[model samples]
Target: MTETLVRIDGVTKRFLENGTPAVEALTAQIKSGQVTGLVGPDGAGKTTLLRLIAGLLLIDDGTLRVCGFDPKTHAAPLHRVVAYMPQRFGLYEDMSVIENLELYADLRSVIGTERDEAFARLLSFTGLESFTGRLAGALSGGMKQKLGLACALIKRPRLLLLDEPSVGVDPLSRRELWRLVYELVDQDIGVVWSTAYLDEAERCASVLLLSEGKALYQGPPQALTRSLEGRTFQVRNISGERRAVLARALERPAVIDGVIQGRSVRLVVGKGGVAPAPGDIGAGPEAVIAAVPPRFEDAFMDLLGGGPRGRSPFADAYASREHPIDSVVEAQDLTRRFGTFTAADGIHFRVKRGEIFGLIGPNGAGKSTIFKMLCGLLRPTSGTARVVGLDLAKAPSEARARLGYMAQKFSLYGDLSVRQNLEFFAGVYGLGGRRRRDALKRMVETFALGPHLDVDASTLPLGFKQRLALACAVMHDPDVLFLDEPTSGVDPRTRREFWSHINAMVANGVTVMVTTHFLDEAEYCDRTALVYRGRIIATGAPDDLKERARGAGRSDPTLEDAFIALVEADDRESLA
Candidate 1:
């Protein structure tokens, strides 16, 4: 049986962004008892749609309905049955996790027996019992989102609306959050989830694909993907190999889109278009462009790249370095503690120069703790860390100066313009004259920031900001680069391009130590350390780690499979 929970009839919203249409009139429908993914780019009016449904934004035209009530006309009554968690969930930072939940329950009119029952169940379900006394500000990104969802669950609303609940969250936490969402729906609750990832969209029952605030399609994510499913040519190439020629061949007007996967290329050729024959793609190179099935990512690229959407670009310089990491960073018995909590317990790892090392873990696996200590942002509770062959604790400043860091949020000065931000960082890092000018010019050209050079960094899109942060990190040519979840919230195409830059740096002999919540990225790392409960639980090549994943209860596991199995095993052990 098909269920329809929320419906939008000719829903339209428009706003003047510097005197332009921020959104166009759009119509969408969300089914009840099913997860509906609202997928699109950064400013494709994702947030606006959520606002219209939440009654926070009044549509310029058309009608919107939720649970049979008009959102604009009967917001109070409609809100009673709906829960909306906006992009940045506002919580009292000073309040304890339990205190925050109690407040939300009171505000939502959840009281006494029902509230207490929900609280207890939520604590156990989310495994948050230990942090009830911890401040909201102290909770990790995943914990905070879980708390946010718990607060929303206080009212037991029939409809749930989430805007990128898993955004910026670690992969394990993301999977857990989705599990909780499924649990809610099993209880007959309706969920309307919005995200930019096609992978996440695969889990949805239906999807409302929006572009420039207009609905392009509305149906099951799978069906929508299957609609245009047809011939795709899979071309294989080495990661750092000369795959650009194959891409260039498909770049003609006849081709729709081309993508890189591990060591293969998925090229979509337009029907009746002028494209190189599969056999004639490259005369000498062993590139095979064989027909294959259409992936969700392929479908997404088709919709996105089929039109005249703006492109994001950045430089991927492959300049070689004279010196290698004769041991870029080495740690022995690294430990970190927060009060009585052990974040990283006796962790040990080594980062070599020119190596692309990926650090991954479950949400509470203590990856961040190790990253902070390695970057010298936090002091270790015990043991030592040697960065660039020097002790981190003894000469922190010099060690820091030798490393470039792109924080989780990119943390570039928001108010400053692209050029201004670049110049500021360059000056701070003691860059001067021709060198600074050349670097700035190259970055502007590479990231396609030429037009928006004067625009505030905050005004840029998520993907652009990701590129800018990376550019800034590489501006001074630091010997070591530390990126903490640098690709979070970025689209898939942009993520690929960003990896291109990282690969260039590795080739240039600048050691890269990265921590990412993305499991697929684990494939790019020469070696990976799976940190869990403040210890190195697994360390090896991605394939080897995948084998360990099978030991954790996953057969024929991918990186994501390994990640989830490891975390779930740890959790079960904890409960036992």
Candidate 2:
């Protein structure tokens, strides 16, 4: 029999927000040498539940135990036997890797050979050995996450709790992080991993699906995916008109959910008791309909309101028309360097009006550098960038006025209420009187911010924060929108809503330049530019990029597969 590492029964936690329970009567167990995933959307209480078990928050009711210690009263002792890594790992940017590790070891009271041994093992497992002298802040997003994991593992605790470690990491880095987790599990460490990615949840031995402070279901991930096996089907658009056909299919009441796949639409049917049929969406004679296996995401969404509406509610408002527009963003031999480190070199790309252009690369590949240069936040060392036909370098203020930029991190005033943040951005964009008032009201209504108007921006859920950020970025209705990792750490439902608005805006002739680690999202882009080591390595449509990956040895590659294949090939060539 396996030992139970952490146990919770009838646990309840309430927040100060009008006595709302963040976690309600949750019951679960973590077993030694096993990976248990806490899976849910933002604001679903995954974070609250993890905090309860970590003893960061007091449980309002019921029993909770960590490594045989009562977390409520014996949190200090529990801390010694358990390690917890929050969403943002507390690593100092100025501190070197070894310095951060040593600080954590000293806090844990590790000394002498034990400290040295711990550092050796951790650095080897996390692949940070060569970067020991590098500053933690200087590491790539993925490397920083690895360093964070190493610091948490210094004590070699019996139980480990991680909250969204791969939130903004590239797919390859995400896979590497999981590999480290599996290695630790092999040594009998009980792991409780919380994530918004459904694909990651499928890797766990068991899963607890939480929503609205409640445990909706608990079981193996396969059980969830297997439940929807026969109900899922693929609608192939033989003419390759994926987006148009998808938009049409979503209008049918029978389609519960659908996403654009390569040359096809994957649909989950029978929402209103009507079976999905080709005729329902008016499929042409060339269309092919076939049953396909459902993924964990399909079943997960079913539990969340029978999946998202097949169509975006914001689509009609922002994307109802077709318009001819000129190039909104142009880059010519753009390059940037800091000291001896070249961040971006001779990068070139052009985004036409009403097009969604995805800029994808591994962490540290200089995507952000290019974005900053194009947005006029950073001047390029050489070459030129233009936004809305205005030179970003010489006429930055003019260019900026016509564009909206959302950074990777939530950059709103956390101390202010939701309304305050909106009004602040409105004022910053130079709106006055009725325009300001009307814009604020329109955003509140469009993004469904009615219930959160009075809430502090910092206290809102991750999903709401994302919405608020986008609302503030586009408060001025700029002609060009720059979103940098906008959907990072957000759940699928929230991401769908985000892109719906994006699609709508593009439909209305708003050009968008986006940087995202979620390679799957590349499918939504009309074109994608692959960046690596500060250079534009490949540029083409999503399908063209996938073909490139297939040529490089991937069999029927997904967007991520294509990206990994390309990056790995480049790495091999550099090594040679």
Candidate 3:
């Protein structure tokens, strides 16, 4: 039998959110050398549970124990043996990588030879050896996440509480981090990992599904998917636009959940509903419909009471038009360097109006650098970038006025209210009086930020934050949109909603250039460009890239698999 590392009995945590329990009567067991996944929609009490386990929040009722010590009374002792990495780690951005590691080690009471040994192992394990002297702020998003993991592991704690550690990380780095966590589990460390990604939860030995602070299900991941086997099916011949097909699927009461997958739609047929025929949704006789094994995401979405509701309020913002200009965005031999390191080298790409272009790469592959240069946030070391026929180097003001950019992190003022943030952005965009009011109203209704209008931006849930950020970026409704991992920590449903709004904009002639770590999201793009070691390795439609890898005997490879194959193939060619 497996040994239990932590146990909770009838635990409850309450807050004054109109007087209710954030977590009520929650009970679960986390086993040693095992991974326990905590998953739910935004504001589902996942973080509250982790905080309760870490002694950061007191349990209002019942009992809790970690390593045989009560978390409420033995908080000091629990702190020493538990390492909790919150959504945003407290690393000093001005410090060097080694300095930040040393600071964390000191805080954890690791010193001298022990500290040296831990740093060496962690740096090597995370592939950060060469970046030791680099400043923390200069590192890529994936590298920073790995560094946070290294800091969390510096003390070698017996239990690790990781909250959305892979939020903005790329697929490759996520795999690497999980591999390291598996190694730690071999050393008898227990992990309670909270994630918004159902795929990540599937990697855990067991999962605790929480909803409104209540434990809905606690079992192996496969068991949940197993329960929904025949109910899931793929709808083919979705000839309409992605959102149109999605709207059609969701319109049927028999469809509980649906998402755009490749050229078709994957959905879970509601309980007691029969398989959908080709003609059921206006498909021709050539359309294919078949039942497939359910995935963790499909099951989770069903538990969330089906997919997102309501049509996107931003639907009518654009009207389809023929583009007079061939290219909405253009880059010519764009290069950026930091001393001896070339972050982007001779990169070139063109995005047509009404197109969704995706930039994908491994961590530190210069995707962000290229994005910054295109957005005019960074000057290229050589060459040029143009937006809407305006050269950014020569006419930066004109170029920037037509671009809407959202950085990877939430860049809004945390202390400000949602309404204040909207007003502030509106003013910055040169809207005045009635125009500002109209813009703010439009954004509030479109992103569904009504209830959160009075709340502080920092306190809103991750999903709401994403909505506000996107709203702020598009308040001016520029001709081109640049998003840098905008949906990083957002839940899958919210991600679909976001893409729906974006697709609507594209259909109305707004060009978009986005960089994302989620490979599945690449399917929504018109084309994707893969970068490695600061160079474009491959660029094509998602289907085209997948077909290229299919030639290597991999049947129907995912975008992630095709990405890895392409990167490896590029490495081999460079070596040759």
Candidate 4:
């Protein structure tokens, strides 16, 4: 028999957290030629596990053998054959896409004979053919993600560890990503993919469910799902947004798992949460309801127990005060182009105070092009974009000064403390002395960083780092906020909390312009514009768009269905 690709014999990894354990002792194994997924919510010890396998973290106990090499002691030798891509894989923003690929190839020490061929193959697989000349900063969320993957693939490692590889990608790009992974597995590479999306995990050969530094379940996704067959029921609530009531019902101990589906929640029966008898749960079982097949989501909810049904802390704590947004932002036939390609075609929109505006689209739909243009990072090819009545093209500095922009993957100096990072940005915003110190203190405290203020940014967890980024972005008290997929890869609870902060900022009359991939997130925006092929094809409130989606021939659609339908329609229209 072929040798096992990875063997972890009771490996335990832990970090000192106020003298408490962060991750407990855990044991797991991954076989060869199979894609094993690490599935969990935020802070579930997914990243920590990957780091441990990559030899980046010391194992407090037990042993790990990757192809017979001990990652802890043989780091240099193991590094020669395995590839680990962290959540924020470094991609040089100022360099062209091709340049970045070549750089990675050189770093891996690929021979000249196969270097060109390797680069071409990686770029082609990533769908970055025509984007070779585009600066890394100019690529969309999906494109940048693909670029990161391509660079990792350039090394042709036998073992691949990818962290949340498809979080912000669109459906088309997601399919392509899967294709690439399949090809890698076909090449006999063992892949360990970490993700929050359980549906994605179903595609893997086996799954290891992690919870708070422990393995909750490990087996074939199919078998684990079959073990709980006939336990789940598709349920719906009569009233919309009254979902709070439905969620409460599903939370009983008897309900093994429940997931939100458009207007209703699919529930799996468990110990304490008994299925509400006929008429007991709105329309009881056998009330002409669909008995849906169990999905990875059902299995996930079963494993973790039903999670919180509301927004994250950032969303819940929104302090809405009346700050009339005076001339928030205006765009008139704003245009951006790349050679013969028009990235933004005659775009026009006005954002007002207390408004939560969103840009929704497919992977290469040019949403990022417009976002960059709005932030003054990329000049418009034609027309004008105004911020607080200041024209970005003519008065770039004046326009940029009125707004705060957070990139999709926000960065911080790894060596700096949370307070230091806050102080640096505060200074950039021109506040200093007593005000800077006070603001720094307030930001550090508000984001719950007071305890970790002295900890280096590099030592912080993903959620903490995200909060630090938010603190830095708004420390200057800007009038408008532009966030590009700010919640991607974040925990569902944290995502909810992040939205609360956004809502709070809007309540204070701060204009919010955001982009996101979580369909449920679309519901939070006051208004969303569906962008496709460089144009706004549909614009309205979430409910309004749902109605339009039904009119477009999809019945009883969720925000995801509405999104795909609108994006498809936009594509067809553009083709026509």
lDDT of 4 by residue, 480-545 (tens): 888887887776546645655665566456788888777666666767888888888888877678
lDDT per residue (tens digit) for residues 392-423 in model 1: 89999888888889987659999999989999
| Candidate 1 accuracy as TM-score | 0.87
Residue pairs with clashing backbones, model 2: none
Instruction: List where candidate 3 sits over 4 angstroms from the true fold.
Output: 237-240, 279-285, 551-553
Model 3 RMSD in Å is 2.2
Per-model RMSD to reference: 3.8, 2.4, 2.2, 5.8
* Model 3: lDDT to the true structure: 0.86
lDDT of 2 at 105: 94
Which candidate number has the best lDDT? 3
Model 1 lDDT on a 0 to 1 scale: 0.76
Off by over 4 Å in 1: 1-3, 112-114, 227-293, 306-318, 324-326, 382-384, 451-460, 550-556, 568-576
Residue-wise C-alpha lDDT for candidate 2, range 78-107, written one tens digit per residue: 989889898876888999999999999999
Which pairs of residues clash in candidate 3, taking residues 3 or more apart in a chain or in different chains?
A: none
* Global lDDT of each candidate: 0.76, 0.85, 0.86, 0.75
Q: What's each prediction's TM-score?
A: 0.87, 0.94, 0.94, 0.74
Ranking by lDDT: 3, 2, 1, 4
Counted clashes in each candidate structure: 8, 0, 0, 17
